[model samples]
Target: MAVPAGVAAVVREMQDRLDAMPGDSPLRDFLSTYQRTTTAVGQAITDGVFADGEWVEEWDVVFAQLYVRAYDAHIDGGHVPRPWRIAFDAPADLPSLRKVLLGINAHVNYDLPQALLGVISDADFADPVLLGKRKRDHEAIDGVLASRVAAEDDELTATGGKSLVDRVLQPLNRVSSKRFLREARQKVWHNTHELQVARLAGPAPYDVRLGELELLSAAKVADLLAPGQVLLRLAVAGFGVVLPPAA
Candidate 1:
């Protein structure tokens, strides 16, 4: 019921499961990217990059378990969140980038707030010393994630395989070209703060708002992957090839 072995072990388990999946399985590409990204962040935690490394290691395990549980449930014909439902049911031909994005979308938009609440529910947010450390450590993850994404550019492009579109967009690897990774994480922190406030006000209202957030985020993912959004999707993909930010 728990990922007691921690983030590194959880990532290894995911990689092993991914390896055993059918070669053409739609889930493989996304899981591959996820595993790589997670491993990079896990290394940062292992290196004591965060102010409260133990807190981060524990939080990472808890967060990963959500995805692990959802994956198992989907495999066993149990219910999962709408975003995950879309991901698990994806057609084999869905683009590699889309698969990666869909997984990110589901985890950050739907699962992150809840995970944050679990990890920090008892925190005294009004205490500047305690709150500041939490915030510092939270933001520290962004740089770790950004660097990891950049380092994996070649692997990510290779995962796209030999499609003309993939080749054409090869130069535009988003991981290198844009600040999307950092911004997405920042938004997750913002959302988690909002959720914590709502939950503090009242559990009933918080439950209602959580449902609303889930539906809204799921709808966004659905729209992003919709067949009618090809041109828009392409434009989004094109952003990856745009120039990297200046140092």
Candidate 2:
């Protein structure tokens, strides 16, 4: 499939997948939530929510294409990144929340840095004024995501039937979601710089660093599959994976 041209195209692509997926398909867990989030972000852009709406729109499109490519690759029996492979290969019986978290872990932790690199050139990184503007716009996304937590929780509960424990923990989950997203994005900015430096060095160095990110992201996703409260485990262990020092 052609890469989505804008946020609206991205939402439509996701919605098409959702419509095609069976109710019990594990992939639906993430796609449905992601579709909703993308719609919200699109609306925010239309509402002039960011200082640089055009930049945010470009970044959003680039960010989403990574996930879309991975999903398409998996479906086409092609090479899938280790992080996404873990998320996609997860058993169907896994909780919807866990499945969604798996997708989030893979996409946010693994795909985000590369996406940042896609939009922010090395020269842009060197310009403090430009970089600050980019960073501010990046953080603006946190507000959009934060606002969706309670509603997303309700959607998840409505579709999958949350346990009583989960129902009681709704407020905590909302707070934790916001916190982790912010933390993850912060790391994404740092990791993007690391990747940018590697890119400046050469394609070989960039590839090696990206491979390391893929491994670390996959490991984090695997950890989430283990027994424990997902949010609490994320809180204790922290969200987003870090890049190893440049070789």
Candidate 3:
């Protein structure tokens, strides 16, 4: 499948995938929420929510392609990233929330930096003015994601039948979602810088750094699978992985 050309295309692709999925497929959980979020993002772009709406639209398309490619790879029996493999292969019986969280873990922690790198160049990074605008627009996405959390929770509840415990923790979940997305994107920016440096150094260094990111992302997903309060655990451990120095 081709990478989407814009946010509207991204939303449509996600919806198409969701339509193709079986009703009980765990994959639908994330794709459903993601589709709605992407729709909101498209609307935001239309409403001039970001400083550079065009850049955001381009970046959003690039960012979404990473997830789309992973889904395609998994479905086609091709090579899928470790983090995405874990998420895609997770048991269908997993909670809808866990399934969605797993997808977010793989996409944000592993795919996001690469997506950032795709659109942001060495010159763009070096230019403080350009980079500042990019960062601000990147941060602007947090508002989009944060805005969808409550509505997403409601959707999940309607589908998955949340427990009383889940109801009690919904407020905390909303706050945690916002906090972690902000924190994760901050780390994503740092990781993108690390990746940009490695990319400039050469393919060898870039591959090594990317390999380390794969491991860190996979490990984080594994950690997330442990039994506990997912939000609380995420608050303590944080989201997104740091890229280690190239060996």
- On lDDT, the candidate that comes out on top is 2
- Per-residue alpha-carbon lDDT of model 3 for 92-128, expressed as tens digits? 7777888889999899989999999999989898899
Off by over 4 Å in 1: 1-5, 160-162, 175-178, 227-247
Ranking by lDDT: 2, 3, 1
RMSD of 1: 6.6
RMSD of every prediction: 6.6, 2.8, 2.8
Give the runs in model 3 whose Cα sits over 4 Å from its true position: 1-5
> In model 2, what lDDT does residue 189 have?
85
Give lDDT tens digits, candidate 2, residues 82-177. 999999999888878888899999999999999889999878989999999999989999999999888988988987646667778888877888
* Residue 110 shift from truth in candidate 3, angstroms: 0.7
Evaluate model 3: give its TM-score: 0.95
> For each candidate, what TM-score against the reference?
0.83, 0.95, 0.95
List the candidates ranked by TM-score, beginning with the highest: 2, 3, 1
Clashes of 2: 0
Tell me the whole-model lDDT of each prediction, alpha carbons only. 0.69, 0.87, 0.86
Which residue pairs does candidate 2 place in steric collision?
Answer: none
